[model samples]
Target: MSLRTGETIKFRSVGERTEYAAKILSADEDTIVIETKPGARPELSAGQYVILIAAETNYNAQIMSADASQVRLRWLRTDKQEYFRVDDFFPVVARKVEKNLLDTKASMTVTFSKEAIDRSPPDETIHPKLWDLLVSLDEKLNLILDRLNLEPEPVEAEPQQVNISASGIRFMIKDKVEQGDMLEVKMLLPTTPMVSIVAYGQVVSSECLGSAGYVVAVQFVNMDSEVRDRLIQYTLNRQREIIRKQRQLE
Candidate 1:
């Protein structure tokens, strides 16, 4: 995606090895200018590379200049050999997507009850006692579903690798999927206070990865901002933990 003025962009500081977000101040065909805070000396120097994460794609950019007011970056094309090495410096595009639970029992129960109620006789075929029992059962199921912390059911027996972030998810699937196919993705984030996000996505890419398995990438469509923020926060926390473990080992 083209960088627009006032759009927030993420890049890593080559020196500090820390990621920072900046707002684009202006952009042209050759270079894009981003605002920098005063008193914060630039951590990136001219000719150094920083990975600019644009949506699902990452771009390797060379720093042209760094000043108190702004920093200029020249984007490199994907055809460049150095562009492929961008992930070596910063793996911003590689996100962890663990297979997770997707609870649909409540919804299923509701649907089943509705069907049962509709099929029941209007006045005489079903006994009053049986009708009362059905009503009681429906009430009980609803009570169970109304809980804040509902027991989750695993969608798969074992976890599969799914590259995921707040923005989207990419996972292997055997089922045929077409580009732009709409899907309702339900996932449970295995974090403290366990967040459940039910998001809709459109299949962006699906390629056969061999053995009848297809790797499908889906982009979230009109997702709630709050859930997206929570996913982002969860990813950040996981990254921190990974960094801490690496430091300990070193």
Candidate 2:
């Protein structure tokens, strides 16, 4: 099948379930070139075979050439199953779910509402005088809070290199978590207006790295459509940025 330049695609080694995100740099009917993050690049050599998933269809491809940044593959045949996934990094915080916390969903909604309001465009129909007055009042309130030292300092999670997709995320943590454990995950995406997401995940895998910590993989559960769309958009934008930078270097 034909592929477009700069289109995001997913691929993994034959017989492997873990997929990696890549961007199609160039393509033709028989051969295609793709680029991936240096860290996420698939371990491949010339003549190796892999599966490429694009546009919801899977294809078997033989690696024609491979390097740290790019790979060339010759299409072999198509598979029957449909698959899709993309990965990227963002700042994230995760914790084991507490059975006593009944208000977690409410807290998540409040956080999302605040971020939505902050990023939304001003109402064009509002009266100019009323808008100015509202802005003035907000400023005054901030000034008063500052004078009283009452403004709450924002609590931010330490940034980590996470492999995030719409379905789940994988990252390293100091603590170990057992498989099948439930976790509350919060991720901050550095989009144009920024997005903060809170979702519940079930731990699927956890591997100890000894002194380095543990690599934990979690699958998202009950994530809303809006949040999933936001994640997909962020990954697409990130892929474009990566492709642009790679082209410049070429």
Candidate 3:
């Protein structure tokens, strides 16, 4: 579902299902950058392209790297025990495409997926603030989605409640939750999770929820494979959805 590096997914809602690849440039908190072009990298606005407008049928892309002049933040990876060079992952800002939006450089509603690979070359350098945002966005979204999608089903021939907890945060769910239920997934950090991560989900069928662990036995529908996949794109695209977005981000 997540258009990862060398991976592909279809976009059905808008038009014919078009497949796209991912090119992760930088991955973090608020923002993520991807090298849209394949093969070798290019200069400013090189192969990178973006939709000059979202109304036309034809598509175009350009550099979307964030400017180096903006603010910079120190990115510390607690688990990795390393700090991402502040200016190593700067995002190049380009525009995004939609049916009808004034993002001729507007901040589009971008999302990421949890399933992505690492394409961030150690030599891939960028500005400071942008890099920090990418890292933060990636980690935050992954943690949020994992917990947000956590729900419990009532075991047959049993009487009990489905309680979910992980990392540190905890919550209780009603017995036998239907698909598409809105689960509150709070981050376990020493703080609160993003209010936006508490998203609305649709009930999906059991067969669609992949066979991962005992989760498949659950009702599985709050988000079907398609929706879940898209969310996964939004959820995991941070580091892996680069090539796909590059083709579409324009």
Candidate 4:
């Protein structure tokens, strides 16, 4: 298997379950070199066996050399897994789903579609003439609103640091939520087009952090293929940006 420089890979010790992300610095037919966070250095050492995952394909490797910033591994062979996981941070807002809401699934679907449409910019290429007319109408509406001293309230939530994967998310919030409670989560991915995603998640864990608030872990449900693809792309893009910034600091 060939690995590209600066590409992100996830790995963990064969005996351990936790996975961590690393950037490939170089690769060859038999060996690959990667840079990981300093905290990971302790878990990896010469002769330690690990499982490395790249683009959903798994490989067996034995560590040749390990240090605070880099690890060299001798690739043993290739393996397979059903899926791969990647995680990163983004701005997120989550609220508990009230049980009394009727037709919850339909309501959530409509809300998700509307949020996506409202946040996305108008595509001028779809219908140029109609786009022009809509732009003119919007301008007139804004003018009328300005004359009436009426303005729409900002609905965007304040950006919060949220660790998110395609399957789940972890964030800190002030409200207490019990395990198994469902929540409506909305997040904005700071990508080229700034994608907005709305999904529902079930609370898996919630731990109080005293004055700081509570740390909540939620697993997403009812996610469609398109949203999952967007999440995977977002993670890959975020990994690239992180690696680029790390190189600049070197």
Candidate 5:
């Protein structure tokens, strides 16, 4: 879709999932100049990514600049890139999934398991809680195997801080991994069923955390759709919990 000047489009900041309308000032194949709507404040920063969605089509773009008057955006994709103008940028609802990706503490484990590792089935084909029980049994089995000097399935130590969402995760590790390294991530979501998701992620960014360790960030390169939906639901529930706690305190 091509948008002309004076047209508005929906805009969303990637990190915070903040949404707002922006009127187009000028546009081309790759870049667009949009005017932020009056009285609407979008906390956008340069170098951050944003999504511009219109007519059910979404375009990912990088924020070049933003001020009271206008925001500059550069399209992230070359293929299927569309121009926009002359439409009202409406505020889009926050993505519950993305919002919960913020840094949080959780019981998570990360490891460099083989990429093609075979997935174990059904955990006794019982309830979700039963599945967790099966996992505990498996852990006990591993411990037994260890005492016998047998090489059991490797399990890493529990992660201290796991910043996760359906899209990716960031955590601190003792060893530094090169950017683009692929690893397996297993996360136990504290939901009703307490879902356990095993997925593969590619290291996107890594930095030294000084005396603590190295902070590594990974983007989910592969995951099941159902698993992603569960993450969204888990995050939404977490948000409600925080609000409830605050109300009690007040």
Candidate 6:
């Protein structure tokens, strides 16, 4: 899968080897930027550029610059940007396909095959719920995902702007989250101490943000598996209802 500007991602912190769920703020061959959540909040512009590791894929990147709005980055392996971008999008012209020029274009539109454009570093996919879950992240969470090494899909750039913020959805462990386990979360309003009704989840990812705190990514992991898929269905339904009512008022 090739990387693009708007895709969602999950990457790990290099040193402590913590996992952070993130979105690609921007990506170039040499630099990239991400907007993360929670622990890195209101203080977004001031936090340090953490060392990050990518789970499964073994992708690693360094935070070159950071702020409340975004964090700049440098990939250590390729010594380039980590995420693939529209600029990198291109069609497999039988000729250019040789040079794979189109594979490296960044114009927001490109055509390629399922096998031809392996833009992702490796082991990344477009998990349907990942982006939906990312819609409500805080500054600390922002910090975490901004550096995400997402499972990527080879996407053709669309004109619509890619969303970079978190899921406004905040998480809490219904049970103690063990290493490599699942958890639960809630849909909260976007802000510090974000609050909301209880929901279910899983721990797909985690990161120790140092003595400061821990950054973990949960994929509505188990509520669905247990409640026999009841919790997720309910949560998604509630979100739709809320959107419906919101549109009605508007």
Ten-residue stretch with the least lDDT total in model 4: 106-115
- Prediction 4 TM-score vs. true: 0.46
Window of ten residues with lowest summed lDDT in model 1: 83-92
Better of 3 and 6 by lDDT: 6
C-alpha lDDT of all candidate models, in order: 0.54, 0.66, 0.27, 0.65, 0.55, 0.36
Clash statistics: count for each candidate: 0, 0, 63, 0, 14, 65
Measured by TM-score, the strongest candidate is 2
- Alpha-carbon TM-score of each model against the true structure: 0.40, 0.46, 0.19, 0.46, 0.40, 0.26
Q: Which stretches of candidate 3 lie over 4 Å from their true place?
A: 1-126, 138-193, 196-204, 208-211, 214-244, 248-250
Q: What is the lDDT of residue 82 in candidate 1?
A: 18
All candidates in order of lDDT, best leading: 2, 4, 5, 1, 6, 3
- Model 3 lDDT on a 0 to 1 scale: 0.27
TM-score of 6: 0.26
Choose the strongest candidate by lDDT.
Answer: 2
Model 3: how far is 56 from its true place, Å?
34
lDDT of 1 by residue, 108-168 (tens): 1111222334435469978978887676555434433432231354223123566677666
Q: Candidate 2 vs candidate 4: which has greater TM-score?
A: 2
Model 6 segments beyond 4 Å from truth? 40-55, 79-250
- After superposition, the stretches of candidate 4 with alpha carbons farther than 4 Å from their true spots are 1-89, 98-156
lDDT of 5 by residue, 1-250 (tens): 6666887778776544567887888888769888886568656677666677666666656678988767898764332522221111111110112222322222222222122322354656667766666665455334333322112444434425566665666776666565545555555443332344555555556798788767777665434566666656666666677679789999
